[model samples]
Target: MSLFSRRKLSEYEPNDHQYQLNKLNFKVTKLEDRIDNLENDWECASQGESFQLANGIDAKEAANRVEKAAQKALPNELKKAFDEINSAVKNEQQSIRLWQYKLGIVNGEPQWVRIYHIAALSRELKKYGYETKLDSNDSDGRFSSLKVSWEGKETSDISKIDPAKKYILPLEDTECEITDSVTGKAISHEVAYACPRDDKWEIIYERKIYSDAVVVPGKNIISAPNWVKSIEPIEAD
Candidate 1:
């Protein structure tokens, strides 16, 4: 029997409640999991899916997909970083310029040409143009501005990205038991690395493909034996 009964699963019915529960009742799960551990587990593993941190790439990819649905987009800082180096190279006009011009470095263009490029792109960004502008007042170069668009109707000024999915990637190793089909023997494989699955917001490991690394999304991934920091061979001690 459950030690706590705030509401049963049936209470959250044929609506948006399941996802909402993941958001609203997620924290409570830590405590619930602990209590269930101390007693008979009321939180059944038979449920569709449990939780883990979605890998970082998975989260970032999710954000990028959303941005693309809006239109072409570029993070402002990406451009600023390019500028800081390009400008540094330009300001070093000391004696390198004569030679740089000879070598056709940066196409021998002056600062104005670069700035013009940014301005022009921003002006027509809504029509599938992209551009960046540096903030002279900001020495750190963090305040660079970016404009990107492809549809000529809507443009995005996205300075930040947030993952839409609930999973956060696990920081440490995940442990599991694997039964060898050939021998019908239960063995253990510790996950050393994990990556995004082809499906949306899913994760996989590079199991068996490389001898040193154990894959994350194998047959037994759902039945976690115990998540731990080290999956060292059991006989190591």
Candidate 2:
């Protein structure tokens, strides 16, 4: 017989059983509502948590400071390197270029590397004061290596930081567009590298989920533009 049939209802002489079924259904409905509320809360929290880092500052704020720092005369070999590279690009005909050169280790030692994403480098340097040490269209005019820091309050000390290090540009994490692994949807991820080894210029970018950031294992860094944002330096273990 059907559970809802009159015969089944009559089977419960005290009517207690039928009443309990109704109570159970009501409880199930309440539980479902609670589950839905929890799901919504989780979604919002997940979205917020993604942009946050182990560092206390907002990723956006750190990125802005980085970008602004790009405009300032950088410290260490940054300003000198930035100036030399920036100057050379202006004389080139292409919008994008990569420069390769060798330079000293404070006492005439040498290193070999190339600076890619030339146009992007030029753009960031434009935000700062323009000065290039490149005296000729040839490589000889370019310092090839950094010697001293630029003259200004904006200088960063190379004593603590290496001038060859890669850094993120002053870009918001939201500027990084990526396809979600789970949803297959495009979304913004926090990003912080801009220029190169010089400043917004170098590549030590903001921390994000491994999936959200691109990494190059075994390579020295230089800054570029949006197209080059995928390169995050991976530290050796």
Candidate 3:
């Protein structure tokens, strides 16, 4: 009986090993099928036929289209930025010319007048039967100076004058009578020279003179000359 039981147990051990081998083979077959399906899905995505991105766009085609569009637009974007920078440089060059001196006749004598103040001097010259026009016949085809003509004859007599006297318009009284807030009395106060600023007259400099015995030098004051009130604002352009 002991010999029969031993032989039966040995037979059952071989059957259990065979069962485990069959189970491992089934698992390997299922793994191969999953790998084949993954390869098919990757091929479809690469061809842009079945696969889509989260935004419902074809992944492969969308990437190619976006890259091509960026390449095509890069030149135009660079050209626009270059044009804007060139325009700014030209504007700055024109502004620098405003501070330069130009030959013009002030009171029938040649003087080096500031380019920005040419319009103001021209207006003042009109009162004395003198006509003025901006001349662009220099090396550059832009207005660099004023051409003054009186009685139909242009003046070309260039001479040097006092630097302080150049570009000086006729002075007008800037005194105004205002009631003092502290004393409640009508007191006279002299303001500064009127300069053009934003289409209005702004006081730029002041003389120390007041009838109220008050020293207010840097006060904000806006006053225009009588001639400035009747004409348009001065501009270099």
- Candidate No. with top TM-score: 2
Q: Return whichever of 2 and 3 wins on lDDT.
A: 3
Clashes of 1: 8
What tens digits encode model 1's per-residue C-alpha lDDT throughout 1-237?
563453564465645676777876887988888887745433444554444444535677887765443222222222332334335435652111100011223657633112222322233332322232323334432233333322232222121112221212222223334689999787755332322344322223333223422233322232222111111112100
Expressed as tens digits, the lDDT of each residue in 170-233 for candidate 2 is 3322234457899989775544443334334443344455332333212223223322322223
lDDT of 3 by residue, 162-235 (tens): 22222222123323345689998976544433345665443443333422222211111213232222222221
After aligning candidate 1 to the native by TM-score, how far in Å is the CA of 127 from where it should be? Answer: 20
Quantify all predictions' global Cα lDDT against the true fold: 0.33, 0.42, 0.43
Cα shift from native, residue 23, model 2 (Å): 86
Ranked by lDDT, top first: 3, 2, 1
In candidate 1, stretches whose alpha carbon ends up further than 4 angstroms from where it belongs are: 1-43, 46-74, 92-237
Q: Quote the lDDT for 177 in model 3.
A: 48
CA displacement after TM-score superposition, residue 72 of candidate 2 (Å): 22
The total of clashing pairs for model 3 equals 0
